[model samples]
Target: MTTDTASPIPSDAEQFGKPLQGWRLRLYTIIFEADTRAGKLFDVVLIAAILLSVAVVMLDSVEALHQRHGRWFDVLEWCFTLLFTIEYIARLVCVRRPWRYARSFFGVIDLLAILPAYLAALVPELHLLMDVRILRLLRIFRVFKLTEYAIEYRLLSRALANSRRKILIFLSFVLMVVLVLGTLMYVVEGPEHGYANIPTSVYWAITTLTTVGFGDITPQTNAGRFIASLMMLLGWGTLAVPTGIVTAEMTSMRRRPVTTRTCHACLTEDQAADANYCRHCGAKLSPYQYDREEEQPVRR
Candidate 1:
């Protein structure tokens, strides 16, 4: 190969269609820290933010969320949003291939995470919707960016995308359950028992099922407590649904492992046509060779 030092190695964004060097890479790395580690971190942060946001919501309803504007919590949340905003921008640059990156699924994820903050900032009125964390939290998938570049990960991605509808249906069913339970809890516990509204109570149901108890609300009535206990037990299965769905798909599409090295007895490396056996050392190289050879016209 002729060397051309004069030729600037295409930027990493140019080389692998992503920039892994420069300040942009650094920023993105800090955001991810590991394989989807950045995304995982983002998940942890957002999870915290959402929990905090939810707490704030419930506290506001129950008149409990604020103790001096939650100075530390507020500071932490702003820091997280700022970090994510920087990460979002850095990734756009890291994915210097605007068209390629933008069209990609994870590219969309990266776009989604930060858009809300900006939207909230741009239009203060919409700020009210900022803490609607459930829907917006899908932005956490941007962490998939950490693994998006690998060829091996394609199987996992394909599996998830293929099974998405089924997973969605399952989740939908869970939502229905939550809705029903929320309504029941609200009615049974009454407005004063912390099931203030159906939706918030439904959120409480989801939190309970996912075992993410934030301790924000409790069923004050004995009957409501009994129902809540049953729901809590049932949550184990509800929480496992998505995992089970994905695992089953993964098992079904499991790739067969192929040995790259030829067997020593065969002395063949994925035998080519006309190959009878090892050219250097004769061996039974034709287990499937006979079958393959039969498919081809034999030279007389």
Candidate 2:
């Protein structure tokens, strides 16, 4: 007798190894088929994992975490890196057409997150040159981005995505203005009053623009104070632009219509007979639903 093993290649396996049932036809439409409560919960677990990854990155940068328990922290970092590396490898093994995914953006990220740790071990000095363990902070965003699969979240995401270019352009200009003003202030205000250098002045400008108001550094001269006033005014409107963009997107997302495509198991649409699920989302199609001859509507 042959013992059954989990398929290294994931084929029709429901989300997170949970069985797909109850309109799996529709459930399978998602990259991660998660229509059940358990599946949904598992999805949350993945999100947490991504957040943990970012926490690890931030924690690694802490001097205390490094100084107090260097060995323990090293062990923890290695463990997390190993687990993520193995998971990345597993994804490659299980995903159909792994090469296709490998070439894609997320595939590269999966590789990037773990590659640095391994590189750190293999090469002597190259590790220092390319310790991308810090880049894992980006992974946190990907975890939150999973909300796009949800109809509501996707709508909100679309709004933000649509305005991304414009927002970036606006931010670039803001940064340029900050730099120019910061340099001017650095020259105008002498070194004794915290505007000692161009970089320091720029840092203060950034803090002021973001409305952080970190008073650790302050300007003492008239010219410096004038620049600070302008920065404060710029901060008020500049900071709100991104927030407004995101808020507007969220508002528009709510007004859009919901679409649940034909389920592979449930024949809900009429087509040219060659249709497999709706062209929209791979819902199984039937000719009778739209046909005039089949007029009776029955309870599903």
Candidate 3:
């Protein structure tokens, strides 16, 4: 008789359960990946919940509505808080390194979105600051979670990043101009003419430069008015500098080809498809091959 030996196949419990595998993998995909139908559905529903919860929070702020529907508002808020709590727990459960996700920008935002209501419930005296619930509004950024699925947002983000230094310099120049103008206006108009001090004059210069025209403070002297007019003129030009810088960067980025492959190490998406390295973090990237014959030129 011949003896035969065969090895047993490992179960999912043995693989995924040990290190971010199994049901956790499926949960992670549904919660974080936009490429799959299930993931997309999850995002859509989550966004809807965020919007609805924000709307309820807004209505709860109105005194008349709060007095009449206070109980209903409390119920809705608790329900939304519970949903977000579950989502936060799910995210932690699915990740191999939960702290990494917890420390990420969106992870912190997700926690803030639910914390205010729970805090208010636990500390009734803190109800006065219920407006903190409005921080949940940051959840609107969750829409960016879909950026990995789009090319335009990727290019836009890249262009903004490229233009950051130029924009910062322009903003610094604007701040210097405002400081100079504010000091001059204070000297020209003096405290008697409603230019109370340097700080107050700076406030006036900022409002005028931004064209907010609050009308609370007005220059009473001819010299101050002239200075205000010049600042106002400069503001229009200042507003365009960052725009032009970003647009120029965007033009250059648009001319280049893009890829949808996300970086696993940095979790960054939208690298150039043919790139051997991530443009954002310089991590290694694997390019997926496409059928050149079937690929058509993309028109901007």
Candidate 4:
């Protein structure tokens, strides 16, 4: 008999591999897994609520709208907060390791979605923090389960990670160029021309190099103008170098096929389509099937 030598990746549930059953299993499937009809529906509704809640927060920020419909916005905000509170609690209740999920990236996002509203209630000054509720929109990625997007996100993330050192070195070079240019401009333009000091000149150098050209600072001398032109030309090339590095890394890496099929045991995603075990926890995977008519996963 042939033997598979692949190792299981470590996950939150690696130590406890027992699969969930009964209603907890059903709830987990609905709330965490996005492959089934019910799961998809739950995710769609959750995403809609998230979007609406974020919109309410945004509209509430408008001074005119706040004056006119502040009370209604407050009510709607609480309603969405309560709804999310229930959902967050459900997620905690359903997961085998509640703390694990609670501490996970999305878990913290889920909590943040509800906490700011309550905090705002206790301390009116904190009302501005309600804007953080917009982070809940990040859930759209998990909910939509677009395989192509998932693959691309992984690719981009890996490319960036692999090229971080090179990018860092490039940024250091840019920083040095900015510092040197800023010092030169300060010396050339002096205080009367608004290039008062090294720090202020460095700020100008950054703005000029990025092409932001805020217009608050101006080069009074021909040398200063020439330096600004050099910085602008250098900026264009500097910006493209990082992109090329990441693109090369991405192109060199192999793309692997993945699915939205989630393991009930560990909650690790991006499982292979035909795999019977969780690649992260080695738990037996539940049978995989999706509605053929709804094969295209929802996009954000």
On TM-score, the leading prediction is 3
Candidate 4, superposed: residue stretches over 4 Å from native: 1-25, 100-104, 123-163, 246-254, 259-271, 274-300
**Whole-model lDDT, candidate 4?**
0.72
Which order, best to worst by lDDT? 4, 3, 2, 1
Error of model 1, residue 54, in angstroms? 28
Tens-place lDDT digits, model 2, residues 1-300? 975222222223322232234443233333343444444565566556656766766676787876777677567667767766665665555544567656755567666666656766676576466555444334344444346335455555566666676678888998898899888888888688878898988988899999899898887878778888888998999888888877775565444332322334432322333344566456554333331223355233
lDDT for residue 201 in candidate 2, whole number 0-100: 85
When summed lDDT is taken over every stretch of 10 residues in candidate 2, the lowest stretch is: 6-15
Taken over the whole model, the C-alpha lDDT of each candidate is: 0.58, 0.60, 0.71, 0.72
**Residue-wise C-alpha lDDT for candidate 4, range 65-150, written one tens digit per residue:** 98999999888978988998999898788766788777866677777677766765666654466554344333233322232123
Maximum-lDDT candidate: 4
Candidate 1, residues 237-265, lDDT tens digits: the string is 88788888877776655543322223234
Q: Quote each prediction's TM-score.
A: 0.44, 0.53, 0.70, 0.68
Q: After superposition, how far is residue 241 of candidate 1 from its true place, in Å?
A: 1.9
Candidate order (TM-score) = 3, 4, 2, 1
lDDT of 3 by residue, 1-300 (tens): 954222332322232232344687777666765545676698787877877887787787788998999899889878888898899899888867687777865567777777766666577765575565454344444344445334466567767777776778888988898899999999999999888999999999999988888998898888888998898888898778888988887776655564445565554545676677878789887545452324555332
Q: Which pairs of residues have clashing backbones in candidate 4? A: none
Name the candidate, 3 or 4, with the larger lDDT value.
4
Instruction: Give stretches of model 3 more than 4 Å off.
Output: 1-21, 125-159, 251-255, 261-300
lDDT of 4 at 83: 93
